[model samples]
Target chain A: MKSNEPSFYEEVRVNGISRSDFLKFCTTMAAFMGLEASGVGQIVKALESKPRLPVIWFHFQECTCCSESFIRASHPIVASIVLDKISLDYQETLMAASGVQAEEAYKTVMQKFPGEYIVMVEGSIPTENEAYCCIGGRSALQILEEAVANCKAVVAWGNCASAGCVQAARPNPTGAQPVHKVISGKPVINVQGCPPIADVMAGVVVHLLTFDRIPQLDELGRPKAFYSRRVHDTCYRRANFDAGLFVESFDDEGAKRGYCLYKMGCKGPVTYNSCGIIKWNDGISYPIQSGHPCIGCSEAGFWDNGPFYQHLPSIAGFGIETTADKIGLGLGIATAVGVAGHAIVTNVRKHKEITNTPETVAEPETKKV
Target chain B: MRSRTNPMREVHVWELPVRLYHWVNALCITGLCITGYIIGNPPALMNGTEAYFNYWFGTIRFIHFLSAFLFFFNFLFRIYWGFAGNEFAKWTNFIPLKRSQWKEIMDVIKVDILQVTHKKIDSIGHNSLASVIYFITFLIFLLQCLTGFGMYSAMSNSFLPKLFAWIVPLLGGDIHARQLHHILMWAFILFAIVHVYLVFYHDYIERRGITSSMIGGWKFIEEDVYERHETESKEKAEK
Candidate 1:
């Protein structure tokens, strides 16, 4: 934020933070990823070799907390690598330029660099009409669409752009949509959280730079390397899920003990994100880590699923004990015919192999003896 | 021990192809159940870092797909055999709509439930009850294929999705279709349990070669049983 002096991050990295602290941060990042301790070397190499990537950060219909969380990233290099080293060319919240100058800079970088720039959008786009959200007399949606046209890769900064966030919830009068809806051709990486973890955002950029292609993505277009599993899958609270120890009320003792929030309408089982595994704020905590339920903001249309505090009767794939009927008509289907069909096909195949000799036919003239 | 008291039945009751289909179907059904449970309820951590027992998922999937192709083609051949095979396995053998044959089913069910002893023997092609079960299992098998492909279509993103797109709306959409597919999996389990039990009950307990027929193609059909079926026919009532 201070344009003149060396920032707090630079001050610490150069003179204050010892080599152990620097190595500790690198090792901490690698460990948070469930990787071996030796992976810290890869991170150390990139930071030591590469000066900083140029970033064109855009803001639209959002609270701007993505930028805020990023600055406060638990690791000091997160901000140093992103904000200082990368030379953030233009950002509404953090840059020195303003008014016509900032808009002009944004356009110039996208045009001059063309396929070399990483476009970062931090909010949902209102499709109903640009009138609802206007920046410099242009709609937020219009700015995002134009900016991404020539960009190399796009990072949807938070749930607002990754999924439509609350702005695009059911009966969304503004007709809001996430960045993916308006984007095509170019690869878009959704770093989804209410405000994504700082290092996760940093890791994505580093990954793009370290390997010239974007990370693999899941069906939802969130990075598969990050969002490959449900928060429930890797949660320390999994024992409670199998044991059925659930939080009946927000203030109950169970919640304090950090019991599973599934029964209290936590969509962690169905919603895939890295919050449980890569706890936010330098792996210090996530929403579930802080004793609150995941609202499933990363998933599309999670807002329409129902009240966040009221659990659905049952998730469709949950065994017969939690069959769909128990949850009423919220969106679970346990159609007996569908699963039976899969099983029958599986059975038929197994039967054939057992009957058929998959054993290699002995050569007509050869003898092993 | 008692050689003369129990006379041996002569000849095989099942054709080779038929026996192969039977055994293939049995093995595939078992494999399907194992993999189906795995995909349905993914493995949990037993040890700290051990991955799930998921290697079978791929193997089981390949096996399941191949077996389905085999079973379906075998079904086509079985239908053809009904028209062209030996008299014991002919199309005319399973016409349960005939009247005294219907009476035979009522008496058979009563005899089965009560464990009643009957001195009269029946023709080997299939008794009325056996014919009905054969038809039911065939329909169940058909349904299993439909539901199986429907769920696989959810992931395969193949022609099935386009062909059965109508099923998605009928069942309430992709997720619901997947759910419906899961719930119906148990119906197959129940059907399989009953099928295996009845086969073993007849073969082991009743001393009938019902289980062996799919392998041997010939039951010990006494001449007296054939004579009884032919003479007892009441088709003239329709004339």
Candidate 2:
């Protein structure tokens, strides 16, 4: 508590990350924040003076993969500083604290640093009589509401906390709700994704410590710095999208070649967030990069989008036939006829039903008729 | 120019070109609505499944596109006419900066709701009051084109669709673009219904057969009304 990470920083040695690598990591983070090159100095000052903010990350009603993903931030130094050395105050998922003591650590931090603490809530709140989800005999929603009430600002860890992920889907019996819904009168920056890339989470925290406030949020209350552009806008398979080449199946050659997944229910066209750019596994690969269609995990309600493997009804304006490329030329012939046939048969049937009264069975010609 | 033809003086009620364009847009838009609705969910065939009836779509689409093309070109002419046509067709003719128009718009609303006539100027070439309605029609037509072509853009070889991709962003996404397209079609339909009713209301109540001016190209302005064409006398006003 009394300033000692510096001496620890001096003694600590990762397998290969040089001092230069750590500084380079900080500078990269500063840049992601849209900070001036000079802002790197502020990051250095905070890292030197603050002894790493004590982050008490709470996980409930989530996959816990957000924590798993954060520690694996590709860059050894980023993972080292934020996950290893960042003096995690108490994490329900990975902390040494147990029972009341574990819960007490978070309470202590809230009381000691009312205006300066960070509350990162991962997963949605269950409101159904609190029976759906209970942590330590209390509802997760009650815990979240209390924690958020005292903190400076809240960071909704992933799509679960931000947009009420799968648990909040249609007919969500748990009554799961996102953090933003319960915590009003507070700044809640939603870092949306199924389990967002580790660096993106670190980047948000770095910006918070450096800027002393949350980064700019778009209309969805998501950080504009991250969720601004769409995945399709920057996807490597974009050329294939334009050229109309697409993967028809998981085992198909087009999939092996990594063509666009538009036909495969990739929600990239409608979804706006960073995935194609800040890919997972240290920018090594993302879902799209790994030859899997993007299920749009970063968006609000991806789970209810049905099975990830099955493509949706063709996004009308976007092409529908993702896996139907076997008889590519025939698709045009087939769909065109389908369109024409649908309209004509419909109209003709309507016309005939109105006019084709059988002469014998039809009402006898009345004087009124 | 009240001495010539004051808007407040209620001279010529509707100008030829502007009025004609308004009515034509209304009629075509109504046609677009009825046909579009039928196209979206066609009637069941009385004939067996194999019986072909493909031309209905072709015919409706052709009618829609042709009418749309006429409306769009008519818009182009109006834009040019806004600069080069007669005094009423000029850009000044389309302005509505009158303090009373805004003040009376509420009165217009009240009167409309109560089925009473509010104090309003008889305008020629769109009254300061009616000009706002025309401008609204103008804006809707533009939106209809953008939305219409955006729907058509999903097809293979349409030019307007390619040129106007901005509609996708306005819709927040393509996943529900058809839903949006369908919704906007109904909007234009509602607009046309109100538009026709208003035109008829003005014609019948105001004693101005303004609906025919679009077809006939001349309003039967009352004599001594100082209709911008001061050349016409009472004797000629009747003629």
Candidate 3:
């Protein structure tokens, strides 16, 4: 089967993508991956010579947004070339086979590839109950464990696989855990976001394909090439933020004028992503550019970081919503009142002691002396 | 009664450096709290036609960074002064190592917190309880610096702030670090309220000019208490 499969270059040629378009696609990938100019040639050489690497993509407790984003990689040539380059042996959403046939393809890939293939996980694993998420009567945890046992590396597709997205939010009933937390002794690359930008996802794949190893990762397991700088750092509206011009309301004049959304509860400053740079839907307007504040979808526990409309997160675990400032201000006022009350009490008690017995106060001093 | 009539002797409790540190730290804390509040909840000022014309937020951040540096250095100076300053200003007074220091703490708590006894516990400098509380406050100060510097590390390329880059992930992430730093500002505000009140109350009850001591570096101690303390120190030194 390996010998019969066409090379990525040959497949791209058959798919009607000209050599110039294919080379342009490679160059775009190299730039996205933060590789130098020479990287374009390296990518072309790798894709032309090397056999397509086997990829086993699994879906668990997630929507198929990672699949959607991947298949829609801005350019049709990119989507087709990347699809052919990876030789995706099994993907739950995109694969044509289902039921017995789908399970057969998955099992065949595991036995066939051994440690030669990469396992790309799309969602979190529910540790609380196996019934919470199951595919073909097998638990998600079971499927993930079996997939990771023989994979070259694991690519956590989105926040779901990276940081346990919405399903793992506050009071996460499913007890969902990210892929890295569940699996160890394997290199896991976190492409973090609600649905990470398609170009970023493609860049990571191209990097793995070219280097035949994982790229440099940040502390959070995200590839430093894309997630190193924050969206705020690269934002075009940063100058407006520095100038203190902000959108007070969604429908205000500042908003229409493209003022900074910091006052509108933008989490761009804290979120690490390439949205401001790579953007979505082929470098079109991202969330901030379209006048919606970032929900910090790339960050862990983003769901629990209070309402998306507020800047400060609500302090967790009081059985009700309350921001840090609310609690802090309450405590401050209480302390001031308590101090005033104590002062009154002290003065009143002193007055009473003076009126009652002057010698009583003097007796303690005399004894101490 | 005899001690009340005894001549009051002016003892130099705080050195000049200690006094300077106190005032500077106070100013830094005040500026930090105000500027930090603005940073957390910035006002939506839509002034000027172009972004380049208004630099209010930038100016606010500059002041915050400036005060933070001043506050950090001032705190370090105080730590050094604890070792190098006069005996009353030494670290020993705040550590609560000795039995007598623990007893004084209990006595102060009883008089101040419980209000069960009218007995006033007096010391020439800061009482053991106040010194110990200040020690805990100093720890909070250090945490504030760590979180503040950690958040700044993302924005600053300087070598100093970069040292604290690990604190953000150590405390989970940038959001948590910023939350802790913001909440601590309120802690400082509450501390100020209790601190100023206690100072005035102590000044009235002890008649030691405790409020003015910070400014003048002198406290009036009863002759017998000062004499007893002097003799005890001499004996301890001899040992």
- Against the true structure, whose TM-score is highest? 3
The runs of at least 3 residues in candidate 1 whose Cα sits more than 4 Å from the true structure, single-residue gaps closed, are A1-20, A32-39, A85-87, A247-259, A310-323, A326-369, B1-239
Higher-DockQ candidate among 1 and 3?
Answer: 3
Best by DockQ: 3
Worst 10 residues of 3 chain A by lDDT: A360-369
Off by over 4 Å in 3: A1-5, A85-87, A317-321, A352-369, B1-6, B46-48
- Model 3: how many Å of interface RMSD? 3.8
Docking class of 1: incorrect
TM-score of each: 0.55, 0.59, 0.94
Ranking by DockQ: 3, 2, 1
Candidate 2 Cα deviation (angstroms), residue B183: 5.9
Question: What iRMS does model 1 reach?
Answer: 18.0
DockQ of each: 0.04, 0.04, 0.52
Q: Candidate 3, residues A49-165: lDDT per residue as tens digits?
A: 777778888899999898888887886766874466443578877777889988888788889889878899999999999789999999999999988999899999999999999
Chain A TM per prediction: 0.76, 0.79, 0.94
Q: Show model 2 residue runs off by greater than 4 Å.
A: A1-17, A34-36, A85-87, A247-257, A306-369, B1-239
lDDT of 2 at A299: 72
Please give the range of 10 consecutive residues that has the lowest summed lDDT in model 2 chain B: B45-54
Q: Point out the higher-scoring one by lDDT: 1 or 3.
A: 3
- CAPRI-style docking class of model 2 based on DockQ: incorrect
Which residue pairs show collisions in model 3? none
